[model samples]
Target chain A: MSSTILLQSIGFGITTAAVVAIGAMGFTLQLGVTNLLNLSFGNVMTIGAFASLIAEHWHLGLAATIIAAPLAGALVTFVLARTLFALFARRQGGAFDLLMVTLATGLIIQYTIDALAHLQVFQFSFPSGSTLNIGPFVFTVLSLSLVGVAALVLAALLAVLHLTRIGKALRALSVDPKLARACGVPMRRMINLTWIISGALAGLAGLVYVTNSLTVDASAGLDFLVLVIAAAILGGAGSPVGAVVAALVVGIASEVVAAVGGSYYSQAAGLGILALVLVLRPASGVWSGPSRDEVTV
Target chain B: MPDQLLRVTGATAGYRGVPVVREVDIAVGASEIALVVGPNGAGKSTFVKAVIGELPLMSGRIEFNGKDVSGWGEERRAAGGIGYVPQTRDVFPTLSVIDNLEVGGFRLSPKECKQAIAQMFERFPALERLRHRKARQLSGGERKMLAIARALMADPKVLILDEPTAGLAPRIAHEVLEDLVVGLAKLGRGILLIEQRVTLASAVASHVTVLVDGRVSYAARGDEFRAVPDVSALFFGSGEAAERSSWSAARGPA
Candidate 1:
């Protein structure tokens, strides 16, 4: 491929990586500790984007959409964790059982958002301005800001997990939930914090996602969820830094493939990479029993 | 002093409708060590689990600090100052030695947790050198020390250790038990030690309760039991007559 082509792919890849990182971090944070493969996480993201769309239609501006979407994500996830996931966990849902619950929840959220959006296939009122050149690469200010926000969120999350006491508790909890509880870590509150944090980041990611493409429908987050899961499992479920790195790798690889192959094949390329990793690396395989005490949230 | 710090009156508890620990009555007092020794399937661990709320009580009551604690969950019991060190898996393997202790000191503020952690390191000394290491890398003896230290970070009034030395080498086992008993006693923590060896019970234990088939075969001071002839056979061997003779030997020695 041409150098310009590669640079452009790199730019697109970085932006896409930012988007994937946000979703995957949230996904992995929940997955790391709770051992839930929440397929519905994608649906939650779509709901959040819709919540922003509602805010936008109400003339609440871009700022309102940013706040509304993430809050919506957090609220939906909180309800699910409290009302649904908690019940299953009580009966020892294990990883597989929780995955089933998440899959069902995802379908419910997707259809519910689709119904609310009045079965419209596209909603493109989102603003996208002139594309700007950063060296040999090109992208809109919107995409740059989307990348910027994702980076900021990831950095903040890392700081929280490392520097803060609550973050320390969260890390310890994911490693061993029962022991975390025995230590008096206030497990219920921490789980709530995790859901809210993950949900909000996911919501922000969904909105940024719609902004870059300048169009969104019910399947917005769901289409992206496949890539998010691939990135999370690739990065190692419990580590946030690893997720960002993996997202970058997947994002760039797929964009480079799109540079050569047709656009329709780019996503499939990412999945192929994930499959290769899973097959070659048995130790990091997602099928192994998740460490439960770490992820009760 | 009161008769007991904890009392289990006619407690029955188990898993999935099958009772592992049958009707059992036991008592433990402050500044005392109660060692529960029995065979593999004799419900020793089950009784410990029931008391700490690890296993649900089928029927019966557990009283702690003169209050009915049977209805209380693990957190409530912990808040009320009951500490439990579960076998092996209790430590957070990925967490650093200090972080594991910090988890144990969960009720404390970050500053207080740090202080307690310092106290733990100061007391154990060995843990201080290994504070940054992940728990998973620790040797068997070190892990047990970490487990007990983690539980002690709660500054609990009553500490229960379940098979703390089960998988350790004999030297490591004796060393861990000695250090644990001495360190916890210095803090005045009430201890319930469960051991398989009769000699282990006689060595550092203050009180010994022989549990046979989920019932107390004999309960007395550790000193009293050590003087008796063939207490090991009474505990490990079979026969009603042998149990009676040993009980008599235990009493007549003094």
Candidate 2:
């Protein structure tokens, strides 16, 4: 590929990285705090997208649809966390069992969405106007806005995790819930808040993703789940900043490979990097010791 | 009785529905130290957990500062004036020393939190020197001290420690028990300590409750407990009639 083409691909990769980072941040936070490897996260993202679609169908404007999506996501995530996930966790479910539970939940959600949408691919359009060229890189207004959203989300999350009292309690709880409780950090409320925030972020990520792709289908989020999980695992499970950096690495590498090898191998490239990282740094994947119980977020 | 800071009566608690410590009663008054000592698998930790709300009592009442807190959750109990320092994973290992203290004072006002953190720094000079360091990077002694200091940040009426000196050096263990655990009691908080080392327990404890087979095999004042002849044999002996009789005989008129 030509140098100009490679640079353009890199720019496109950056935008992809932005979308992936949004989802990965939420995923890592949920995983880190709850110790639940939620395979259903992608399905929740799809649910958010469908919420936006329904809002649009009702003649709601762009901003209204955007707001509706995250609200739906948050509500659904909170309900599931407080009910199903909490029940299983209380029953002494191990990490692997919780993962299986999420997988089952994802299947249920995916099938439910598929049945509702009649398995039809819906065309999603957000006006991009004209592509803007910045030096050697090109980006649409939507793509740039998506990147802006990701930046805002990151900044907001940083402020919450570092500057706020709730954030300190969250960090402490994520590390050790028992100690956090003993120190008078109300765990149930904090966990509920985590579900809502992570769910909202997942919804926002879905909106951004579908905006970039210009298509929405029940399978849309399922396809994107691999990239989200890969980024989260690569970034050390719970760290949002780490997830963004890892997303950039995965996105750029995959886009570059797609430029040279083809789009089919792009997803494969991301997975390959994750596999390589896991092989090289096994300890990163093993955050909790064997004796430690799964902490419900 | 009204001044008793913590009291556990008929507390039969354990994992799941199986009781590990049966019908155990213990109490700590204001500025007093009550120690629970037992051999391996004797359920000393279980009894402490029952008091701290980590384990539900199968049949018991846990009262704190003259109020029945039997149904209270750990956070509620902590807010109501109980602090806990676990044997392991006690500190937020990833957090800096100062941040750990801040988390400990989560229920306090911002001003009180700041003041409490400052007090912890003064109390633990080593923590002050390494205020910016993460808890994971601290030595065993430093981590123990940090855990104790973090518990104190909440200004609790009672502090529960589960094997605070489990992995410490002998000298460091003595220093922690003397300067930190005993010191906190002197400051007027009731202390419920679970220790494996009887020697250390004897030194600072106002009272000691010995457990065998998940039952309180012996309960007496610290001085009376130390006066029991063949104390090691009493502790090491299986929970049988012969051991119980010999233990009672060794205690003389107790």
Candidate 3:
């Protein structure tokens, strides 16, 4: 393949990476803090996108939708987690059982959205703007904004995680909940905050996704979520930096593969890389992410 | 006992309602080190866990700092001036030493946390050098020191340690009990330790309790324990450690 096409695909991949990073960060944040992989994350993303679309229909400015997305995402996610998820967890469910419950919950949400939206796709764009040329690549205002926002958000998250006591408690909780409890880390309060924070990010991920495609529909989130889940797990389920890096690698490879070969293999390409990494380096500490055993859910 | 930091009476606790340690009694005061040593299935760790609120008492009462914290969770107990170090997985292995200390002092203000961390660093010169290193990278003795430092972060009124020297070399285990454990007691906090090394326990322990078949078979002051004729044989004669599984759930195969 020509270098120009490769670079262009890589540029496009950056946009995909940013979206996946946000979603993965949200997913992994909850997974790390609560030790439950909330499979309904994709449905929550769809909810955020729809909330934004509803705001747009009211003729609110784009910024209003931006604010609405995370608000909707956070509220919905927190409620579901605290109510439905907590009930199941208290029933002596193990990590695997909790995962299944999340998966089933996601499907219920998808069906609910299907009925609400009448199984239809709706137009929702970021208002087309002038494109910018950087080196051999091109990007619109929205695409650049997505990348910039991703970088800023990631930086802010990293700072909080490293520099603050709350961050220390969070990291500690994720590593060992029992020990964290012993250390006086308030599990209930911290857990609630985790759901809210991750929920907000998931909502932003929805905005990142729908804003890029300029379309809103029930299946939009579920379609993109496969990649996000892979990125979250492969990134070690708790590290935001790891999630973004994994997202970039997977996103770039998929886009480049689509550019060079059949587009049909793009998703397969991403999963193949994950499988390859898992096989070749099965041990922890080799990668920045924690070992799979450390986080069973 | 007048200045007691911890008191447990008729404490019965186990996994899933099945009794592992039953009807036990123990107490520790400020400047006292209570050593609990027993065979593999003696339920010593279970008793420690019961006191720390990881395992709720099936029956009986636990009083800490004159407050009955029977229904409290581990976090509440910690916040109430109790610190704990488990036999294993005591430190967050992935975190740097400084980070682990930060978590230990989770509720401390910035200034207080900084001061506590500094005190720990000064107290453990080796830890100061390894502050930036992850806990997993430390030697066995260093990890033990780090665990103790982490538990001490909150300046808790009481500290509980479970098998701090389980996998350590004999010399290092000796150093832990002789040097660090003794030094910690000098700080005037009530310290409860579960150790398998009798020689080590005999040196610093102010009190010793021997458990067998999930019961307190023997109890005495530290000097009395050391003065006994055969410490190992006192509990090992039960032969329960070989027949029963240990450290797992008390229930059978669930």
Candidate of highest lDDT: 2
Candidate lDDT scores, in order, read: 0.79, 0.85, 0.84
- How far residue B97's Cα lies from its native spot in candidate 2, in Å, is 1.4
Clash pairs for candidate 2: A34-A297
Ranked by lDDT, top first = 2, 3, 1
lDDT string, candidate 3, B1-254, tens digits:
35888988889999987999987877888989988888888898889889989898999988898888999988899999988999889899889999999999988988999999999999999999999999999999999999999999999888998989889999998899888888888989899988888778777898787888888777777787777787777777653432222211121122
List the lowest-lDDT window of 10 residues for candidate 3 chain A.
Answer: A288-297
Model 1 TM-score is: 0.91
Best by DockQ: 2
After superposition, candidate 2 runs with Cα above 4 Å error: A286-291, B238-254
Instruction: For candidate 3, write residues A1-297 as lDDT tens digits.
Output: 888898899998888899989998888888887777777999899999988989989989878988999999999998998787888777877778888888898899899999988999999856757899988788988898999888988988788788988887888888888888899988888888888889999989998889888987888888777778778777776889888998898778888988988777777767787677678756631244333343322
lDDT of 3 at B54: 87
Q: What is the TM-score of each candidate against the true structure?
A: 0.91, 0.93, 0.93
- lDDT by residue (A83-197, candidate 2, tens digit) is 8888888888888888888899989988998998899988776797689999889998888998899999999998999888889889888887888988999888888889999
Per-model DockQ against the true two-chain complex = 0.62, 0.83, 0.78
Better of 1 and 2 by DockQ: 2
